[model samples]
Target: MVGHTLELRGSPFLQEIIREVPGGERIVHCLQCGTCGGSCPNGADMEYTPRTILAMITANQRDKVLKANTMWFCVSCYSCVSRCPQKIPITDIMYGLKRISIREKAYQETDAPALAKTFTDLLDKYGRSFELGLASRYYLFNRPLAMLKMGPMGLSMFTRGRMSLTPTRIRNVDQLQAIIRKARELGGVS
Candidate 1:
């Protein structure tokens, strides 16, 4: 675990996050049991594990917590949440951290923010994911070289009928947009 050398103080930042996230108040009950960390699929890539992030939240390591890549590493697999004995809604907390990081401009330089934006843009525009479009857009800006590398794999998937050439729009996309709009108005994930 990375050392949290930040000065300790009361964290209104954490309080605000707790209020924003569904089931986030349960964060205060974290047991430091390491289950969340152990259960995380990408735990090895995180600067702080889920358990450590919770501790940092309680310890008022606002800057460290906000800047850490732990939040970005979360794949939303819900493994940690399912394994948590305290049922702390670890994934939701990760989402809250991501939102806070974006709002505060505190995250490290990474493709995560770009990928998230790309996904949301595609979803909002088409009412569903368009993998080819998403890959094209994401690679155009983030890693043009990676696009070359992915060509063979993409071709393989296409040949195998595992990848679609066209995006499938959901029925009643206007209703989907309305629901998303209402969720955003109600302080749901943006």
Candidate 2:
């Protein structure tokens, strides 16, 4: 009889971890060539650039990166990946790193509390986002007073149907959940 390999617990399956995301392995190819840093609109604002984050993760310094403002400042623009000579998926790394940071509660941005609650609640309740529901949830989560300060201007667009009232779920919700479960198991956000 052939013996099956034993997988240890809490021991990083680095290969499995990298394969969890579609383009994560590309992060390993970064040369620290500074292309990502140079292309970022907010480069001057970050102590550590996207390239540096990738380097830190590879060095097992993920906690250090999680504590920094760099992840919060990323605008989710794909410019870094688009211009990467190594074809590294810098944007996805930024997202994965942010998920880890938020999951750990290592860094908190005050403006994000409403957003975080709304996103989690959306995923939990409807298995997707309803734009109007999200907006209302965010406003309410932030409190009535906070939204009241914005006056009629804040309520205008949402009331006009610029934001849809419908909830949309991706097809194959179970598969999506399974993928998300894998991420959560690895200490990443759903």
- Candidate No. with top TM-score: 1
Model 1: what TM-score? 0.85
* Candidate 2 vs. true structure, TM-score: 0.67
Per-model clash counts, in order, read 0, 0
lDDT against the true structure, per candidate, is: 0.85, 0.68
What residue pairs clash in candidate 1, if any at all?
none
- Candidate 2 regions off by >4 Å? 1-20, 113-117, 143-146, 158-190
Winning candidate number (lDDT): 1
Candidate 2 lDDT over 84-105, as tens digits, reads: 9998877777666666566667
All-Cα superposition RMSD per candidate: 5.1, 7.2
